[model samples]
Target: MNNEQIMNLIQEISEVQAAGNYVSFTCNNFGIEVFVMRGEIKKSKEWDRTFFFRKMFSEKRTEEMYQECLEYLNKMKETV
Candidate 1:
């Protein structure tokens, strides 16, 4: 999963293409979000920024969000 895969996943989520420093995908119900910020995952225990999160009504535990994160994170780690 490269940038292309991540970008495609983001599009699948129906995320709003808003202007911001970070690209965000939010699940309001679960209060979870996966975003790309400063070329890294936006949520890390070492460094986290969730100020822009908005609630999502979609039921989780589906392949949707997991695939997105897995692809993004896996590609990011591999590139490192």
Candidate 2:
């Protein structure tokens, strides 16, 4: 969506401008981003907050966990 359209879509949710490649928001308690390419939504992902820090935490931040979390979160979105 365009910026105005994007803002309307997120009216019920909180959207913040972060210095990065995607737009951020909250979904299923996981930080989510609206993936875009060439100024258009490509695919959105429900991020496990520490998405890029898995190597440092030694926690269960496996790919499987990420996929599972995304599956659950996407399902939540489909319902909306």
- Best model per TM-score: 1
lDDT of each: 0.44, 0.35
Model 1 weakest 10-residue run by lDDT = 45-54
Question: Across residues 1-80, which tens digit of lDDT does each residue of candidate 2 receive?
Answer: 22453354354222222212233443332333432211223446443232221333334554444455344434434443
Q: Which segments of model 1 are wrong by more than 4 Å?
A: 1-30, 38-56, 60-62
RMSD values for the candidates in order, in angstroms, are: 11.9, 14.4
Q: 1-80, model 1: which lDDT tens digit per residue?
A: 23464466566333322322244565444454665543433346332222222234343543455565656544444443
Q: How high a TM-score does candidate 1 get?
A: 0.34
For residue 48, model 2's alpha carbon misses the true position, in angstroms, by 13
Clashing pairs in 1: 28-55, 28-56
